[model samples]
Target chain A: MKKWVPTVIFLAVAVVLIVLAIVFLPVSKSVWVWIAALLTLAIFSILYRDNPIYRIAEHIFVGLSLGYGLAMIWHLALWQIALRPLFVEGRFILIIPIAIGLLYFTRLIPKVSWLVRIPISIALGLGSGIAIPLIFQATIFEQTKASLVLPEMFAPGNPWPGIWAIILIIGIVTTLAYFFFSRKEKSVLSPVSKVGIIFIMLGFGATFGLTVMSRVSLLIGRVQFLLREWLGIIAQ
Target chain B: MKRRIPLTLTLVLGIVMMIQFFIPHQFSQDFKNTALEWLRVIGGFAFIIGLASFITHHYTKIKHKKEGWAYSPIALGALVVMAVVGLIGRSPNMNWIPVTVQGQQISVFTYLFSNFFTHMMIPLGATMFSVLAFYIASAAYRSFRAKSLVSILLLVAAFVIMLAIIFYNVLPLGDLGEWLLSVPNMAAKRGILLGASLGGIATSLKIILGIERGYLGGTK
Candidate 1:
């Protein structure tokens, strides 16, 4: 009865809000807008407590996304590349790929599950091979090159750029030293590594601040949707 | 036979793919394209297997009347409805189904798809993420306590960044926050990126050389 009381009160309040939205809001005529507004509220209801309405909306979201993705994959990939070429265009060469792709289904059969490894091997091998050179080129080499600040940064009058460049170089060295686990804790690199940790913490703090801001913005958006779009309580 | 063949395929294909990156020949490009096309088709089949697994899992839960069993039917119903609408609505040239409503030349399937995605999916997804705001606020309160020198520095940095972002013109902390981000933060980020990339390359090489056989499953 205690749980039921809150549930009943919440529902009563929700009904009142919906009634106000329909009667006062300009967008009341658009059925889609009302649906969207209700769905948004239903999702937000999870904050109060898990209920059947929120669960239903959550399940539907997952199912719809999965189904939409499958339909797209069929039309974009399987039909276009494998089926159409093999049947309509009479490209017999596609049969090899189609045959290999069929091996992916061998997982459903215990006796022939080993066949699935072939396709997995091919995919893993290609993906890893592609990643190696690209990762090196993009992250390691480029970042190292960018870190090498030029002497021109120290050119006359503009001391701030030079100071920043020096600080960055020191921060990079210390951060790398911190990650280098090759040496003992009592070694000469220990102090530098400790400095590295400070920079890392500062970086993490900035990241957390930015993340909080982004999440708050999303909350603000939903609030604006409710107040301005649904209830017309706030001016545009 | 099972293990040896797959490992050999990994080794050969991995080397070929790596070498093809350096090669500028037309044959090499064609080989890469064919490999990509094969990967796409195989990926589609993999997605089907995943979908089958999802449906089977839900069906089993419903059969056993599990804790959240009541929601399974809604999920299954939504999947079927969306799949039917998306597949049928995409093919407007089929000319079998009526594609007009109330004198407006609109595909009903397309309209349903757009409505479901916009009204149902987008709102739900966006609101779901928005719930994180309250949780993040609570977490920040618990974590931002100044216990030591390092913790104090971290808390100060966070406060500065947050204030700068929210009221850049009102406060002079924006330039300080920007400086912190561009210099020290960027340096640390670059260092981490370099280390991770090196680690990734090592793992990729290990996989290619068949040292990482965990991906082959525990069958053999």
Candidate 2:
């Protein structure tokens, strides 16, 4: 009886919402718009408690995601990735990746599952081979180069500004040294490393603040739903 | 068949996604785009699944009269009410309900999602996250000992970064803050980024190769 009370009320309100949506929104817009709002709250409820309702919602989400993924793979990969080049462009070389991707389906077979690894290996080897150098160039080389090399003083006559540049260079060097786990620091090098540590904390704090903001945004959404949607005190 | 097929397909698609990045052929490019689209669709569907799970889980708890089971009704009530409004308020004909007036077509849902979801959830999420500040401050207060070399380094860095950002608007202080962010700060961040990228690459490779099967459900 206690259970029925909420379920019944929920069903009643849901019916009203459905009726209102169908009558008002464009057919395409209505279903998705409400579904998106409801699901967002449902996910957020995980923070309060873990229950069967959340699990059911979770599984349905998984199945839907999987199905959607399958559809896109068909539309994009089978047609665009593998088939188009093979037939339309006559790019026969495309067969290699096509074959490799197809090999992934081998896991369905009991004895031949191991065959999937060959293609997987080629993907990893090629991906890393390209990625490593690109990462080094963009992040390591570019960032360090900018930091180490300064512009010629804007005012050549001003010594005070160049003094700042010298200090900046010193700071950058000592900070880098602070990260070295293996090095034994003697004397002033120790203090320089100390300054480096403070900079790292500030970066972490800013990122944390941004993450908090996104979460707060999600909570605000649910509260608004309870007041405006269920109560209906607020007019549209 | 289900298990094998899913496993194989996951492996194949996963590998293709990784390799496509390097190869740059039209096929690879298409694969990447398709994979991204597929992920989005899957993510959307996952949202519905989440809703369903919420209802089922809470309903069961309420049924069993478990501790805190009373709250289940509130959750189930919320889910059903929202789902119905979403569905019924979506049709074109004279429809069972006339939620909208002539030119200003509106429904409870439009009211809910637009007004409620955005204004409420977003801010709540941000505030919940802000609670981290108290936790961080308390943790630092208790744990920030200046005992050793590494600890000292950490303490000083923490102090400078905090002081620089907080006192940034002042004359020489602002200048110090800018220098801190641009030079020493940037250098340390880069070093951290370098190490992290190396780790990410290794993990991505492992996952693509199926060597990292933990994500696939453990030691079976």
List the DockQ of the predictions in order. 0.71, 0.10
**How much native contact recovery, as a fraction, does model 2 achieve?**
0.10
> Which digits, one per residue and each the tens of the lDDT, describe model 2 over residues A1-236?
66446545654675787577557643334343355445544544444455444444444344333333333444445555566667989978666566655565565576776655544444444444445556666776776675553556436777655565555555556656666556675855677767666545544443333343444444555555544554333553
- Give the proportion of true interface contacts each model preserves, from 0 to 1: 0.72, 0.10
Model 2 compared with the native: what TM-score?
A: 0.52
Q: Residue B34 of model 2: what lDDT?
A: 51
Which stretches in model 1 have alpha-carbon errors above 4 Å? A2-5, A24-27, B92-104
Q: Which regions of candidate 2 fall more than 4 Å away from where they truly are?
A: A1-236, B1-11, B22-28, B46-53, B80-104, B145-167
Error of 2 at B212 (Å): 0.9
Q: For candidate 2, lDDT tens digit of each residue in B1-220? A: 4234434555565555555667858986776665543343333333444454555676788788987665556545544444444333332332453256456666655445343334333433343453344456667778778787655655655665556556667677667556555655555566577557656667765655556654333323
Instruction: Tell me the chain A TM-score of model 2.
Output: 0.66
Tell me the RMSD of model 2 versus the true structure: 10.4
Q: What is the interface RMSD of each candidate, in Å?
A: 1.5, 8.6
DockQ result, candidate 1 = 0.71
- Candidate 1, residues B1-220, lDDT tens digits: the string is 9999989888888898899889989999999889889889888888888998999999999999999899999989989998888776666564344567667666778778777887777777888888998888888899889998778877877788889898887756888889878987887887788778888999999999999999899878
